[model samples]
Target: MAESGAPTQRESMADRIYQALKEDIFEFRLIPGDKFSESDIAQRLSASRTPVREALYRLEREGYVDVLFRSGWQIRQLDFKQIEELYDLRITLERAAMHKICRLDKPPPALRLLNDIWNPDAPSERAFGSTVRALDESFHCELVAAADNDEMTQVHQRITDRLRIVRRLDFTRPDRIDATYREHAEILQALIANNPGEAAEKMTAHIRTSQEAVKGISLERIREVSQQHRRREPGRP
Candidate 1:
């Protein structure tokens, strides 16, 4: 009853749209502060407005977009305040998760997942940054998953999505990339040794250090974009 090669509708139009939009945002194809209309996205993706709307809603919840009044969606702007809040939450949750993982007689599948993503021979800063971001996220997720705590894992998954944006900025910074990889390797060693206290300390320190690095970077670009938006508005006092 279907065309031989056509994708099934049950494949879920909303999911398809979500994946496309998520990738675009993650890869910076849809840069922060870029505005897009739901109607335009629907037409461009050949998707129903329903699916596009659903995808946009999900993106908004994920901190990738914001719904604008009397206009379309605007990509969510990254800021120091959000970055600090995210890292603080991450440090708390990840520290707890690592402690629990270290106490287990045999750590769960998550440890293996983290090990698999480790690469000592990453070629460039860009590649190293990307690798570090992926491995760092996987490491935290695995720790939560290993703890068998569903609520904490869900909380961390949400945190990870927001952290991705920060990681993107941090990883691309030339001075931070090598230091990050070194820190990650140290953390992994502690986790492998089942030293919960050390692991927790290292993770917390790593996050704090990274947060400081982000804060140190000038937000001139973000400020410039903000000014541009303000100027475009009709009547600003």
Candidate 2:
């Protein structure tokens, strides 16, 4: 058992490193395109470079980071094409999940949890504030989790995590926040009413709107960056 425990402990350490790295990225403590060497991370975390490298590869597989040959690793910068693909996949996966929930002989109990937070009468806005976006993401995740389809939930989770970097950016504007609140309420109403068609339609429209919102924000940020670069150029207009 000591031999077996040795491998388990190493795996546990690697997982710990992975979770810590993931949180840092999610919270923007380590923003996109930030670079660091495995040695740096290993020293910072008090672990060996091997586990740090293992953690980074796991992140790379999930599209969270990239390995730089002979250099270091970098938190992945936003990729518009990849993000758009994730949104499309979100629509496809979630539409199917919505259909499944509505077709159920009875609504999944998860709806109760959703309703607790999402009922229009609930004061989630006042309480949640900016965190509303996180809860909104959770609402969709919960649906997939409760759908009783293990395969679907696993795939959905991977896609969801991939898009999380930008998903909340959709709610940055006040109007977008209001729209999300209203849209989520409508979708839940359809589910509660057992109207699969309307629910799926609402899901599709919500995701597309969110996709456009993210793209708009990303393009605006890119323009800002380009203008900053031009201002710094030695010869400029």
Candidate 3:
């Protein structure tokens, strides 16, 4: 009960189910093109079919899932054309935000989080993983937010939300993780120096490299793991 005796609101089960499914997909547990029925999700999550169906419908609307027959759902595939478009859009928006950011007399408060992330002894220090990538996504979003433009931040968020499934895979290799950290540090240095031109260049390079890295890892892992799963089937010839 609240201090004023007003009841607190409860989160809907459908929302929970939607986030659970999204997390699984974003982490690659539910790989691209993997299919399952409504019953399958309901049983696995220990939730009723109604909420699962509701969640699937919401995910479908967001381009994360698609309806296959009457009750089947499949995780959407990440292809080169789609990724290229996403990265292109990302570059345009982010570069604009970086320009706006450099015009400011001071950096946004979000820089504190970025500083902590880069520091190993800091509380926010995360190695290469989905968590780190989620932070990376947030960093870009904060960049836009720091521009203080509402609409731009919203659009950047939508793109980043869907791109998470593929973007985080760039850190699969230790070398890639090291490269990301160094590049991020360099980008930060440029931003701190109030050099929009240099920051824009560095940001472009960092994002493009990550785009290429994600393409290789996500595509190859999907193909490699899918083949392994297929071969393990009892009837495989």
User: TM-score, each model?
Assistant: 0.75, 0.82, 0.77
The runs of at least 3 residues in candidate 3 whose Cα sits more than 4 Å from the true structure, single-residue gaps closed, are: 1-8, 69-71, 119-135, 218-220, 223-237
Cα lDDT tens digits, model 1, 95-148, are: 998887877777777666555455445444334556666766676677777877
lDDT of 3 by residue, 1-237 (tens): 124454656667888899898877765567787889988888888999999999999989888888987757888877678778988999999999889988877888766667567653442355657656766777788878887889999888888987776675466677777777777777777887888899889889989988877766556776665556556653211
How does candidate 2 score on lDDT? 0.79
Candidate 3 accuracy as lDDT: 0.77
User: Among all windows of ten consecutive residues in candidate 3, which has the lowest summed lDDT?
Assistant: 228-237
Give the CA lDDT, 0 to 100, for residue 122 in model 3.
44
lDDT of 2 by residue, 1-237 (tens): 024555434457888899889977665557676789998889888999998888999999988998999988888888878888888888888889888887777888898878877777865544345587778778888888776798998888889887776775567677777787788889889988988789899989988988887776564564454455456653211
Residue 98, candidate 1: how far off, in angstroms?
Answer: 1.2
lDDT of each: 0.74, 0.79, 0.77
Predicted structure with the largest TM-score when compared to the true one: 2
| TM match of model 2 to true structure | 0.82
Each prediction's RMSD over C-alphas, in Å, is 7.1, 7.2, 5.7
